[model samples]
Target: MTRACATLTLFLGLPQGTMGFASSFSACRSQASAAPRTALLRAWGRTSSGSSSERQPLRHLRRRRSEGLVASLSTKGEREGNPATEEEAQLLQHLSSPPKSQRRHQQQPQQPRTSTKRGTTRKRLTSTGGLKSLPIVTPSIELLSHASRRSKKVSQDMLIKNARNRSRKWVAERMDMLGKATSKPLRDIIRQYKHQLPILHPFEATLADLTVRAREKTGERTLQSVLDDVNDFRKVALEISKSAAREGKLGEKKSEIMQTMDAGYSRMEDHFLTNGSVLEDLTEIQKSLRSLPIVQLHLPTVVLVGAPNVGKSSIVRAVSTGTPEVNSYPFTTRGMALGHMFHPETNARYQIMDTPGVLSRPDGERNEMEALTLASMQHLPTAVIFVMDLSGHSGHLSSLDNQMQVRHELRRRFPRRPWLDVVSKADLPRLELEKAKEALPEGYLDLSTLDGTGVEELKTRLFEMYEIIERILAPPPEVQR
Candidate 1:
């Protein structure tokens, strides 16, 4: 019996959890059959459960410092071999309780020494310019119970088979965020992620597949196009590998793992840089084919035009998150900024640019409006959003970067294009956007982003206008340049 127990302990490769199970079983506290318990131990990947003469070699590595993650949920930091600090012992005790989000935000400080968690709250957090905070919130034990209930509401798989996966109940309460990433087909996503899985064999790049796609998508291949994708793929692989290494969670096979990544990256890098001249022309042709449709979608862009200190940036911040710095003062946004936020449910995506403040007299500066207008034009926005300040402070609308100059430039550079107007700042009492709307005889949408009023209805109106431009301006496949 002693020899059998000793053999069973030797095969359990687990460092901490197995040792406790071994000691407990050997003590014979419960009356479960020995054969079933021994079989269970073997199923946990033990090679041999009963080799009496052989003694397993013990790990000689020193006890490492604990990673102070959600500390309250940690296990006993150290056993006889695992010596841990006093703080670690307290952390493990806290982990045994409910996680963050379970505890109220105010009570989270009393949690563990680290006291961190990701909670759900839609309150407007104070943000520094060009920055946002990432706060940790705690969760409750009732999470599992909530998930189980929701699973029943969703589907049989979600309710029954995926009971464990559905345990995250708090996620369903918020708006569906997964919809964006799920835009691609399930098969395409599976294929993309599948390529990332560690492969024992070399993954070869196919020239034929590219040829097929070139013919199918655009009926020709340009050299610049293929080279661009090749360069992009190389950059992507290197970034992915470096990020994985930086995470420091590779565990036992880290050296072997990094070596595999380095080898894979080198294989592709040598192929591209070493054999460049022969492939250059074909790549360009491929890119040209892809460019055809994109060129058609791009019309002369209409940038959100405004002066410093006049809620120009605020309208940008409110309407579309183009990252124009919003403040009570003037000239907060420095460089021309660009960002895109699509509607949650619809396929509507607005190409928005939050440009540097457009002053009447150049602040000894290059015409910021002209520069911003040119910068946005490269994107080929179907329509323009001339976001203006409506709060009784739109300084000399016709004189400042004036409407006529803007219209003349667009007509001269990109003729037969569409441009729209957006008059902002409806929240302030004295400001009347209706008067501001008259500044642009082309017409405008009256909106107040601060109050969240007129936002949705205005967006709906913008999309309707976008559809009209799409039909009128979208060029066919034959027009190359």
Candidate 2:
């Protein structure tokens, strides 16, 4: 029996005298029948021969020994009301759990997948996606001749003029030079305009459209038509240059090469002469666009608007960093002016814009100044401060009724916008008409920029409006988290 236990321990891969080995062997001897014991001993004796064919009998013996040990443990547990011993429980746990390599794989962090394609980088979007600034557009004639000037400079090189096979080389060179010169500049200008048009803020786009319309000639051409014409001329010029150069290359004639180059130059000149007015108009439009006030859309803005000479500029000058021209006459603020104010405690910045006076008239009848004011109120994300002068002391171009009509019309057009009303030039005596008094909205703020009355309150209210706008524009909590 001692030899049998020793042999069993060696086959089971457990150390001698270990608690598990001792427990398992003793359990197997006590619980196993005589027939199984004899069979296991016979198998062990065969394994001692060290024959490869005898290894199966040894494995069978070890499996039977394990079964006997488990049966003994289970029967004893039944009597004791427990199903397994500590050693048996540990054996089962080791069998049930995953392998060490698999557990390690599960514990490791995953990495983000990388893309291998070119130019697939992500771009960040701005809060307002508006143009930050306008690109400088070169003057019409200068821009048209820029490529020619560059080509001329390149042609002036002595080595280029005196190279071997000069006529053939010059014809090919001139083909490339003239083709690129005639087309590239025009293409660049077209690309610039195309790129800028799509990203323009709505207000600026409206102004641009109005400017183009004002300069448009009847039954002649628009800016876009002129651009199309330039493109067509570019194509024609390229075709002419390539055709002439190909003919010149077949047989090198200096006179014919010069004539081919002259043809290309003449095509370019014809394009410029035909589209000169439209080109000048485009240049002027670019200048106008650049002159426009740069409004930061992310900042909470308050736009001051009303009829001519109602002291909108005065309010802007009093409450904000803007110093718009204050005058006794109408249309003092012919253009948009942007200014800023900062909260004393939070240091949050707010924008204030002074726009030109809008007249109470149909859209088609409105002048450029009126159109500009209307554009501001229509498109900007802003609070409107409609300034009214009840004293009849303004340039008198706009009566009290006209001012009220302008306010009502604007409010009707842009309902649900943050709005306020102000009676400017408060020190002067007001109109005695009861109708004007009744027409005035309740809680309208009255202030005199001359003596600073109610300016502090206006600033306070503007800051409060900014806070409300900030909450409205804030990102959701989940996104912020």
Candidate 3:
């Protein structure tokens, strides 16, 4: 009985000697019968509100007692020892350990987490290289009218009480449209022209300036001045639009709002019309710029220059890929003609230009066509092939004396250029040819395009001249230590 009392005390985690053996057995039976499983477990120190150290021994004793009780209950019918009662066995099974679900949850492993953030992409802008890549400029008047039409299409679905808000929105939208039309195009043109003008090849730059000067009227706004005026108008228009919108917001009556907006619109229209000619001038300049040739400055160039009807175009057509008109009149090749040739051995490319005929005259007295030839001589890195008509039989107009004077003037102006003289019409009558040879300067190349005489020789010598030019222009070789 005492041993049974001690065993009951260990299972209940109660103080020793607290009950007599008879009392302890009865107490255990009464407690198991009267209290709930959870209450009994709390008394057994499984979840008791005692200090951890005080509860620890009780917990160990309860675990061992429950194991023994379970073993005894499992062998109740087979063993000879006294067995546990049904209530005590049920309490032990429920309170000795955690629930099955919770134990399973604690035994499982957790998974690692991954990030879900996305990366951002950026856009890149491409650049047009130079003036040759400039797009066509839009006409200012058309742009202005288009903007006005777009602004007029704004929605007018506002309440009557929101007249002031509506007016502000309308005015803001209209001002934005006006700026896009007038200021934006002008700004783009100014930016492109300013950027490209300085980088233009010298000959192209001079030709462009001459073209602009020819179209410009006296006492009027120049291209830059017109651009400035348009920009100023943009600022002024913005200020006027803001003031008008503010006035509309302050207006009490609908008529006052309408009047204010109408007045602002009228002022802007009048300002644009005042500078209508400026827009026209800008349009004309765009046309002229687009008309200019796209000259490649990297290649070697050979330029043909002589008086009109002196077989300059004929020689160009015979020697290069050019096919200029072979007319017997003066200034047949009105503009600069460009062609290409290739070196046989090196596979290098060359530019051949046939310019309009230039007469022997002072700079001030020269025409636009002649000015083009002069611009080439003054600007381009080239070899000059001065064609002469000593036979005077191909309807040539310039006298031999005048042609010689022109040659002397060009040589004096550009003394460093490589020059080659060619006397055309070698197939003329024997008497005229002999007379021409007598009058010709030493080292003249006689050629007849009609029968291809000296054509191949001329091409070879031209390539040799270019070789000399290349040698002069090339960078010096590096020296070894």
lDDT on C-alpha atoms for all candidate structures: 0.33, 0.53, 0.52
lDDT of 2 by residue, 283-378 (tens): 444564455445566677788889888887777878875454322111123556566888899888888888788788886687767766665554
Ranking according to TM-score, highest score first = 2, 3, 1
Residue pairs of candidate 2 with colliding backbone atoms: none
Q: Count of backbone clashes for each model?
A: 34, 0, 0
lDDT of 3 at 410: 77
Q: Sort all candidates by lDDT, best to worst.
A: 2, 3, 1
Query: What TM-score do all the candidates reach, one by one?
Result: 0.30, 0.61, 0.60
State candidate 1's TM-score.
0.30
Model 2 stretches with alpha carbons more than 4 Å out:
1-170, 217-221, 252-281, 322-333, 395-397
| Candidate 2 vs. true structure, TM-score | 0.61
The most accurate candidate by lDDT is 2
Task: Report the C-alpha lDDT of model 3 over 1-481, residue by residue, as the tens digit.
Answer: 2222222212222111111111111000001012232333232222322211111111111111212111111122322321122222322332233554554443221111111113222111111123355446554445555655665566654774587667656555654554455566666766665445433333454455555444442333345544444455555555555665566667666656556555555544444444444445555555655556555544667888988778876777787754543212121236555667788888887877787877888876876677777766544556788887766653445667677778877766555567898887777753345545555667989899999999999999889877754543333232223
Candidate 1 lDDT over 1-481, as tens digits, reads 2222211112111111111110111110112111232332232222222321222222223322232111212135412332112222232333233444553332322211111234322211111110111111111112112322332233223553433233222122110211111112222422331221111000000111222332433333322232233334333333433443332233234343334323322332232233322233332332322222111123222346554445545555555645533211111125444434455566555554555544443323434233433333322333455555545565665333354455444444333334565656666654453453444556556677777877887666656655544443333222122
